[model samples]
Target: MNFDERRPIDILETIGEIIEAAREENNLLKLEESIDILSTLIDNARFNQREIGILNYFLANVWSYIQRIKFPDEEFPLETPELEKQIIHLRIANRLLKDTNDNFKKCQIQTNLGNLFSHIGRFSEAQEYFNQCLEIDQNFEMAIGNRGFGLYYYARVVFDATQQFIFMQYARKDLLNAIASNQVYNEAKYAFAGMVKQIESAYPLKELNDFKKYKDFYKKLDKKEINYKKWSAENKLFINPLNDILTESVVAHDYLFIPTMILKSDDKLFFHSMFNQLKQEFVSVRFLFYESVNSPKPHFSDKEVVLMDTLDYSDYSFTLEKIKIAFRVCYSIFDKISYFINIYLNLGLDKNRVSFRTVWYNNLDKNKGLNTKLLTTKNWAMRGLFWLSKDLHEKEFDTTIDPDAKEIATIRNFIEHKSFKIINSFNETWTKKTETFEIDRQLFYDKTFKLLKLSRSALMYLSFLVYDEERKKSIEQSNELTIPVNFLKIKDADKI
Candidate 1:
């Protein structure tokens, strides 16, 4: 019973039960003690990945319960440190569970991750996780129901009418499926049915676009086209979850426009062209990254590979360089998005000074938080971008979602302006004594892939922010002018 005096394994055995009892008896003191004991065990004791994952999952659940107790309101998304703590632990648990074969635990962790993401207004990521849960076990009622429930709430916040209506239809379908599954809890089933009814009443079936065709084309085909499903367990380092995130983000970006507004100009074409170019750059980077991962060996015949007259043969190869290039390009895309933001918002901030990391802050005083003009826009996508920017900022502005944000920035800085080494393995001696930044090659790849995902998300948010503003402008200027703009499709041969 004295957990403080028990061995790590012994403590792990009893900790879950102790926490459950604490929750059952409403014993906050006991719960707090258990949390401390588990944290100590995790940090001090030797354990396998699975054990660590188990401990983290329990800790995350405890935090979740504690936060729910502290904040009983169900209307607004939670942004508390406690909630963030839960998310952090759950993410760790998910990563640790990746190689494990425990479908039940994977389902639980992924479902909770989805739930937490939804709780924090990151509905797209949440939906992706929920979809991942379904991929693991098709009959997972929690994920099934949560997806429907989350989609309903997500639809409420979406600004675009067509997208909103499409999401409502999807939500209705999932809710109905959840109800039919017969495994969902009664309360959840009631909620699902209620959402379905609301969707039906708000957007009638006849008024909506063909949901089947839309779903099949957009949702189903995306994963296949991304080719991430082919990434195997053997290639764990190459299997980035951000691949899914980026894929889903493209869906969001494309969904921003619905072809109803009749006003256009050369400026619109220029902006659209710029957006297209940025997207192309990102796509090329992602392709190179994947190709580097898939490459069996460096090809001597390839013109790109042969042109390297001065090559470092010290554990260096073209594949590695490709990865580094991808990382550099992906990181640069963030600044480009920031540049777009600067021009679009017309903040008149110095062109050189504006950056993704600094654009959201006040020109004079970043300590004042988000910029005044940004705050006034009240665009959800813009607000999301502001928060996303915090993840890349200094510790004082961190969002707690990415603990490695500072390290990532440091890596990017080192890559750009200083010495950065991506070794196959960690060299403690060199890493500790040398001024050069060194990271395990796998870790470097992971970070780069993450940067790519972040860039993709930023691009999506930028597009949606423009859509939100444009929608508002159309409403405000309804009586002002009517400009007929014609659309012409570019041929596939001239697309580039």
Candidate 2:
């Protein structure tokens, strides 16, 4: 009947009437008919910027609802192709309005683009568009939720074992962000929970120690203990307690103590001096003590007590030796914070910590630090850094040394001032990382001390190369005597 040729107002009126009729009839088929009528109106109408934007919004809502219905096998129906066609039509309608400089229209178009890409299994592309929508309007809950779903799908496509862990990390982050921003997004929340369950199921560690950490996490979440007796578990990733301890020690030293040491010390020499005092204090402490009767001889004699007392050991004598050792190691590593700051200032390294502290303090003052504010910001940064360094050999580098200095200052300020808000904020940041990132004491140690050791070793080798060029030449000569210094030798030497 050439209804599409009708006037714009007439087409809108016709569309409204059809949609109303479909609603009144309560028929799925009629709803489809109404969609078809609206599609035709949108295709033909010479809509203004505002009108096209509104229509695109309407179309987006309709498409989202339609996509929710699927075949018995949980696949989209054959009618989905028609929906995709309508999405393209909607995009065209919005693009025509782009010259009007309408942000709302652009956002709608991007959102629709994200939806279509997601439907077609182009999850990465969908994520791009969804991110564009968020950039236009961060508070757009729908866009946020949709981006979360896009990430979930992208995670599913990841194949590499190591990369799958990282994919799940981003997927979980996006889903959690969606839920945090919009609590009503049940679909996104469900997807996030389901994905976490899948990861835990696939990588179930068999050793009691490895499982204990997850067990503890689940216990804190009030999750029921898994009944291991029921399933025939295979392939356990062994837990190395020493490795765990070293990892956590490194993290804590790098992030916690080092920062504090830097903040407190005036210079490197001062820091090292104080560090030596602390180290001696820690090392001299005889944690194992024994009581002696008046008649019996004392364990080391009064002479030994006087000798040890003359040193820095007497004060910390009652503490556990391991605790003292850890404290000393923490203190020692912390003393290097000044080194990091000096290097950063001289080398023009990106001071992520400076901005991080500024933002953290601002949020703390506003009482917003704990409620997904700092965690989200830090997570974003971590994800970015993780991806940036994924292929690099510097994964174990001490990144927190400079940042931890500021953190220590902030923590000290909060402690001295008795500011509950600051305390709560700091605690929140720590707890959130612990919970989501699987950061334990051992992980912290590794990041701080173990990384420091590795970094120092590398630095020592680099220094040796710089200082002893002759030694390097001699080694190269020795190597050439055994094997020619060709491409393979060069490659091997470069590795060293």
Candidate 3:
């Protein structure tokens, strides 16, 4: 962590920023990492009361924030041991700062407590704390937004339209007031954006004639001003969209059809690299996917009901081909990187004295080849990619496998092993409650696409590292690389 090189507060602030990003992005890896770092700091750092209080506050609240976002429709009853630990941290922070006169800090704790209470359906206790925060300071911008968000979340589970309308009316007002109180604060803007979304698309409140006035809150402004689209994109793409999660019967209607890239059109490297053949193959698969989505065969009446996956592909053979090719693509990427690193490791050695060919011929673990043991398994390969590209230790990166993405390893394993385990057998049924040997095609395609995307991203990133390292080695050996006439590319015959 280079802890001695950085100030303690700077480290703490960085951790706080990471935690906030996790909440905004719903990144479980980032959230878990921020918690681990904070927990370590609390146990190890010799901080004073205020710093400790701050650490405890973050340790407690970040978990609650994630749970609230992940399962907003239901109460996060503080029954789980994890939630209980967060509550303990909040309680510790509360007691630590009780004697202090930090109104803002006290108000934050109060709001957090209110949030926990509301999550557990203790509405009266939740209201008491929110009212206490407002009583502490009527203009506390965060507390104001907190009340608005709390109301917005509460309105999710409430049934009556009249009750929802009333709660939303107050929420919109509090969110607006919070923005007015702090024009530059991101929290206020985000809360205001949430309020706008709920009024427009999230809930069926359009018929409330009185609620139409709330449309002025967003106004005919530029789309970027409210950043509603940006928030929605973050919700889906940052992590997997969880709208249908937290329920077994959820029918996912949202899908990333064709999975377009967000890169600029002028970025030639995506299509013009030495691995252009594999890139084109991947793109071909995407085109097949596009065709599958647009194809029509069956028609159903409005009365008909059939369980269907929103994200699906009809081209099963081609989908499997894409996955197998993605594995080869991932292997090629690490192989190139490993080759360059091995070259760099032998840079200063005397080839004539030790016979570089002898070292090269040996199948060392670090050898840059597909068959090398450096990252023999898919799990190791995933972790190894980060190590090659990043200057940080593997421990420092948030490297937990996403639940959806973890299936990538199993599919890859079955592909490498040619096992029918990828498909369920009749014996694998869930105690005969459902049909046996059913394949979750949605899960298969989703995970395979994840591996494809993961390999591409890691390949592109490590390619730059390989290019620069080889360039550095060429320069060290006093052989300047020849530059391409048109594109100004550098090619060193001596470099990998």
Candidate 4:
């Protein structure tokens, strides 16, 4: 029967009739007809908001079911383009829920979006959406589990030769989160066990230790009366030194030994280069940590520790010295400039009403101006600046940048001298009131970090430039001194 001929009650009855007919036929053609009838009813404008939402949900389900039947394999076609149609359908469903302020509706859309993304191998994005769904309704156990599973699956896809270590770390986090939020103990247990198996298969050497840890976790959950058997059946235990050591070290700042062999005389240089590359890598990692703070995930404490330890053994002492020296020089310049600006120009010395103009004008009054105390205070300021610079520089350098001893020393001097002038210029142009500065503390912090990060980048680039120049000159003069690309590896020490 046509939708126009039906009353509101009749429409409801018609929907039920369509559903029953579709189910009774159990045929694709009849199912399609039922869906068409529902669509026509939905378009009639007679349905209220609730009915529209329900009808849309039903339509989504029908589409999902059809897709499932057409492509039974979750990993069908392998090519992303083949999934474009499915993604489009999912997107349509998601858009329909945009105005759905109800938490349940939001959860439904997010869950479906997550599922669609996961199917297409976009696990990270899928995990994010699934987590959103869970946040709206923590009791939505399926979404919670899917979020974790998505992370695990995504980790698997990216767990190739280049970044296997990173993948394993992420995998561990996803699996752990999945189990924690799991409602059914069997589900959690089984997922956890499966992860343990994957870990073992991927990394065999440290299997005993890894298995022991998983066994301990499993036993704890089992003691709590969680489904131990299901978990045991699903997951096999295994381990690797990298994962075990890294995880332990990160979670607790404990040291761990990572074995290596020096195959060539140039191994040290390679290690040094790798060390330098890690500065940017660690920064990126830190940024990721910041971005992923909202997610139900674990911290990369082990990865951080591994990176830090690796740096420590890779000429960390020299790196710190270089950074400290550079910082001291930069601070000296800043101190001198700040002193002139504050005491001579009277820029920042007011206890009551402070501003650049007032400070400058006050400094013009010789009676209220420059004194031993003022100069001494400038030195103290210099020391503070020096400390801040040194701390940040050391952190960045030790974690990321590795330079040759001579080159590092040169860059340190260059930055100390050059950056001081830059800071002086920037400060000289300071027109805002001191009160304003205090009011916007976050702005100041952000600006400070930005300047420091920029200065660090410049210093790194200049160091490389100097090295390149030296290499070119040497080449022209004679081939006696062959500088390696990575300063650290110029020695016969070790490979990264």
Candidate 5:
């Protein structure tokens, strides 16, 4: 542990060797010691992006092994801050290695990210990370197998037949592909074997004609017989385009809109309205963001007063203004989702005090973790939203899902209460303590886009959470004779 005379890279390598040896020998105590040293090194040492990435990647792997060693008899706690530390480390590694030339390491980090998210029951994000891994290395067996494995769990928890069938068919294909690859991974073979047994034991899905048709539909997609782009564009569905950065997120969001019949209830009306509002707000923000990036001219109303003191003249443009609006509005949507949770769940917290960062806890006590209502609901999507909220909260010195979460939070605060500026230059000269939080226009734009993706995920999770609850209600009240209620779809002509 004494690395006083060693270079940072040397220290990192030493720790990696120690951790690997410990893992190979099953030395729990030595592994725990290696974890502590690596954490200390990460906190205290100064290293370039590549070195730090390697360090975090090693730490994440060691922590995963430690968790399995410690909890041999049970699944890792789905909502624990302790378990999320592994996620934080892997995400940090992923961000740091984003531009690295090492394709194998890139694939590894992404695969670990997917695995952690799946282990914690955040299957939506898990699938996205897996998709990202496969994008980097399409034939990566681990990513393929893990994605299939995650989908099986995802299919189990979901209540819709369409979702279940789609996930299972894809899962089967990925698992088979993983198994049939030239270099077979043992884990993939094990997963496929386990999956086969489970499906064969409970072979009810194939009996449904509707689900059988869904399998064929997926086959057509695989065979390229169906033009997905044409189908999606014609139907106005937000399907994933190939190689899109937001492909998985878009796919997840599209699935949330699949038609489902629910009995009429007062809460249903309110929930539906909130879902609509969230969707509209998200779409508006998304449009404004793209418009800002794509617009050629700055449009302004002549009636608006031009005050020199009110603007940062250094980089003043309508595009920047539009981007700022998108960022602020996108940030607000998270709190609005929190408001929805408070009212819908009847948490009875003070309405004005509810926040996305604090709404899930009992009396804002994060130590108590999520409230009993959320825990009892048994909805994975709701739990996923709770975990997503953690990414936006102020973590002091801790690592958040977004490496720049603290700065993003500061920018949001300044935009609302003080001054926030977007400049072309971002260098060491800018002080963090300044009243104006200045950032480069490109960085600001990137963060805003990231926030939009996060907001999209939050909205999707909210919709699915409601869907899960509605399905549960229908099942519980199956014998009740409820009156039929019809709802009309909002056409393009109905847009405001």
Candidate 6:
């Protein structure tokens, strides 16, 4: 390893070899001595870009590994001053390698930086680094695990509720990708599973996208495709699993309700009719709103859609029309859920007999507390079980649910109060954030999808809650002789 006659590459390999052997033998003093010599060589030499990059990267890698091994049993908060030393080395390495198109070096530096930034809670910068590393190679495990790690923290700090879940969605999505790609970090699985367990214990009725999460993960893994794209799943692309939203509507109905002697034939028809209406709304959403952004068949040309508008007020009506229909579609999915449950509970024969309904019907048609039930039917769980999401299950529900509720709450207010905030997030770290009544196309697309997911989750939970109570009362009655078996067959069809 003589510096006088040897080439720079050979000198670096010699230094790296000594450091590796020292590390392998558990000789901490020798490892530090090797790093010191390598560091001195780097500081004293003036080499070509490739040589300098290699040397700097080696120094950074050695320092970073040494910090982890410094206290083998210690937890990796990555907060020690030694880790900060690693950050400096990696930054120098990244700068030296910037001119060269060496992805391995780029990924190595960026991943270390992401880890340090995440520990410091600078999530925006951390996300940037992790994403950059993944761009070099999606299968890069450090980037994958650290990217998910950054997202989890970002979700914690974000102020907007709807925006928080969007972060978590990406968080869970990528973390699962990291897990499925390879087993580089056994601890990543443990950390992720712990987070999920906490989420469940905190929220009683919380469902992770109906617990059919990240099916896209398997699709990507199956193909062995590095060029795989995300943000394009049929369910994830737009709001409302556009490909199979219809199936979900019926599935929600069957899973939430149980047929009993109290359920009349007309009540069954009423519930079915509500779902049919929901199918229509979801169809309109796909055809009118989602299709416009998803394809824009009429406007696309030369691989981009250029909007050239010369008319002054003409654009106004069309924009308003889009808003009206999109809102209507999203609202219908939500509004009908209340109607469906209300119909089943209030339209039945035993409504007058029950002391409490334990739910509220949102529609004006049958919300009169079932036959005006003469004496008193207590508003047991508030006006509606989910009024302000005040129920026990809602109280224990995950933070994810509230964001959806927050977004949908604003929508409800828009109709009832005639004014609501439509927040348009300009870009990452919010270079421009505004609460304008005017619709930003991309913002609406994102918010609408979140609202759709929330609506589905809430309805499913509500139906389960209401029917669960009904089943309890029915059990007390022991009315097995009068129970309907037809609906029981469909009950297991959508159990989460």
Per-residue alpha-carbon lDDT of model 3 for 217-263, expressed as tens digits? 33455754334323323222111112111111121212211111222
Better candidate number, 3 or 4, judged by TM-score: 4
What overall lDDT goes with each candidate model? 0.69, 0.39, 0.48, 0.42, 0.71, 0.50
lDDT string for model 6 (356-388, tens) is: 122332223223432342113232211222332
In model 5, state the lDDT of residue 325: 88
lDDT of 5: 0.71
What's the residue-level lDDT of 75 in candidate 2? Answer: 55
lDDT of 5 by residue, 1-496 (tens): 5888888868877787888889888788997787778777777747778778888898888877777787777555556544676778888888888998878988999988887776655666678788888878898988888888888877775666655666666677677777787666676688686885675565454642233321223343543224443333232324221111222322322435423555445325566677778778877776677677766666674237564753333477677787898899889999999998898777988789888988888886566666888777577888888778878855432446656788789889988899777776565556464967788888888899888777877776777777677667666746645654455677768786
TM-scores for the candidates: 0.75, 0.34, 0.32, 0.36, 0.82, 0.39
Better of 3 and 5 by lDDT: 5
Better of 2 and 4 by lDDT: 4
Per-residue lDDT tens digits for candidate 1, residues 430-464, read: 78845688888778778887776667666666666
Q: Tell me how far the alpha carbon of residue 453 in candidate 1 is from the true structure, in angstroms, after superposition.
A: 2.8
Q: Which one is best on TM-score? A: 5
lDDT of 4 by residue, 89-168 (tens): 34454555556667776677787778766654344345557766766777776576555556555444332343444545
**How would you encode candidate 2's per-residue C-alpha lDDT over 341-361 as one tens digit per residue?**
224223233344322212222
**Which runs of model 4 end up more than 4 angstroms from their true locations?**
5-26, 48-50, 73-75, 78-86, 159-496
Ordering by TM-score: 5, 1, 6, 4, 2, 3
In model 1, what lDDT does residue 361 have?
72
List the lowest-lDDT window of 10 residues for candidate 4: 232-241
Give the lDDT of residue 173 in candidate 6. 61
lDDT of 2: 0.39
